[model samples]
Target: MLFKDQVDFVRQHIKKNKLRVFMTILAATMGCAFLIVLASIGFGIQDTMRKEILEDQVITEVEVYTNDGEALDISKISAVEHVNAIVQRTRMDVMTVSQLENRSLEGNMALTNFAEEQKSNLKLSEGRMPTKDNEIIVGYQFAENLLTDAERNQMEQNIEEEAEPIGGYKESLIGKTVTMSLQSYESDEAFPENWNFTIVGVTEKPAKDWIVDTNILLDDSWKDKFQEVYNASVEGENPDLFYSSSKIYTSSLEHVKSVTEELKGMGYSVYSVSEQLEQLDVFFMAFKIGLIFVGTIAVLIASIGIFNTMTMAVTERTREIGVMKAIGASPKLIQRLFLMESAWIGIIGTVLAVIISYVVSFLANWILPMIVGAALGEDSFEELSMTFSLIPWQLVVIASVISISVAMISGWRPARKATKIDVIQALRQEL
Candidate 1:
């Protein structure tokens, strides 16, 4: 028979048992929808986590660490390909007390190269970079941490009571002159000479909300002056220990891998956010596969219904099958007709399921964040772009293939049984 005739034959049979076919299709739809929605959770979470990781740090920046007691070779690192700029910082070993008017606070002091910092894209919230030896840049939270003696005592009390500390210097600190007094760790005495610094700018805020940046950045020229005081305060101290951190920035994100590999090969420890993301992708890939596997079980269960429906169809049309055979219809043609009916059910059900899954995913992404934020009593969560369910085109294709393939397999046995019906016996049966 022609393909059109076979399709019409299947359509007539389906119309005869419209209610039964509808329910079968509904079952298949539910199975496919369940699989897509379930697997989407895995995809959504992986995407959310990946975004969070990328936001936490610069992808093109690599942190280099020294091995053993060795010092990092800046000249060698600068010579590497795609290396745009490098920022090196040396932290003062002795605790320094910063005083501004009646307010005083102990702040971390680090000497850094301003020229390299400019090349590394160091941002400032206000003012310009320091040029003179006495000029310096402060962290975003530096002014906030500068408090009077009474305010400091109150802050400590609040901390003890597990309450958020409030009240800090709110005025702009631009062009303010502050005095820093270094305290000797060994003798527990303050250095007689105090260094005065003019605040030229404030560094940009950190990426994470929880992070508090209050570091004081001075010119690398001060390193000699600070080192002399530090050496005088302590005996037999390794100078290399003062070199706190070194970071290398690539010209583009694509160069991060090459720069990191070269640094590693030169016997230096290097870390970058891009490397962490690579590991994260591998882990989530396996996790998503497992979810898809579990969801496929639902489609398999739905296939059982298809198998039963096709078997009943074969039994009900036994006389028709015999009549077609008595004429000139081949066994393969009869079987094909049955298979086509099952495939139609799959196609219709899968299309409907995909539409439903997208609607559900949209609702989930929209409503879940608000619900979570309300439950946690934190409105900040609602402000964040958090995805709860995500369905990609790849997922739709996978679901369609599985649903349709299962339907065909389920109908195969029943289609074969229809070909084996005895024409003589079927002809004698009641129509």
Candidate 2:
């Protein structure tokens, strides 16, 4: 068939069935638009969840410990290709006797940079990580325990009972100094070592017990010297355990497992964030699949509507098909004309779908916050961030292609019927 003749015939057919063509195009447009909007919703949700996980800290770091009574080579781990930074905490046990009004909190001290990998896991309530060895960062609960009952209640009132205690306390004690009478313990023996701790930072209570004892910040040389002095003066059983605990920071969250796996190969017991991240990714992948499936159902209904319209067009255009055949149009030409008509419908519908998708996406997002926020009360949901729809170029392209293909497929049987139409019988038929 000549291209010009096919185009002419397609235009003629469309002109004759204006109402049916419009409706079919509308159905395809609605379907494609529905798919676009749905996909955007899926992407938006996935992006939001990913941000939350990162904020909570992903599997970008590992904590390494020993299976036996020996220290793993920190140099070897640091030299690993994916290693970004490394933090090794050397611990000391000190009995803290308060020099202020009668109260005390006993815990071990450890060193940290407060940057790099472990930072996200330890959210500060107030102040900052200590740069000096004498400054201590205490857990909110640790400081709270030191507070007298009257002081505690007064704090609850001042900061609001529901306010994060660590944040409140950290702010409350910034630049304040506390004096401690430290007792050195060696195995079962003890000696007094008077010391002072300035509350430089307050950290939110951690999920683990060991984190509570990690307050003192010592540099490497300071750490080694303190460890030596502490061990020599205050002997303790299982001193080797403190030497085993080390933190390995990776270049990124994804590299954490690689470093941890290497450590495992060298015979160290390691815990990493990568495992949890993988599990979360798998779960979200399944959720996105389910969402796409649900959204595809709407598009399927639109495709069926297109099919119905195309089938009716075939029946209505029987006489027209006969006239074309009589006028020297081949069966292939007739078939091509029908397919061309459906393609045009798909093309036009896709254009409309793009416009509709944008409007729908905006209205949906804009209306949702206004309605929900008003209902929930404005202040209650101020912290919440959500994107109701996120339309990317990839989604638009996919939706357009799918819509066009579906339109052509729906017109298949109609096109075939037109091809095989007996000229004599079709001429006698009336619309």
Candidate 2 segments whose C-alpha is farther than 4 A from its true place: 1-5, 68-70, 90-109, 113-153, 157-192, 196-216, 220-245, 269-273, 364-378, 429-431
Q: Write the per-residue lDDT of candidate 2 for residues 169-248, one digit (tens) a residue.
A: 22366666766544555333444445576777777655433344335443344555454545566445525324425777
Cα-lDDT of candidate 1 = 0.89
CA error at residue 80 for candidate 2, angstroms: 1.6
For each predicted model, how many residue pairs clash, with residues at least 3 apart or on different chains? 0, 6
Index of the highest-lDDT prediction:
1
- Model-by-model lDDT, in order? 0.89, 0.70
Model 1 agreement with the true structure over 159-270: per-residue lDDT tens digits: 9999999767888889999999898555667877788899999999887889898889998887777767766755675463265788999998899999999999999889
Model 1 per-residue lDDT at 46 = 89
**Top of the candidates by TM-score:** 1
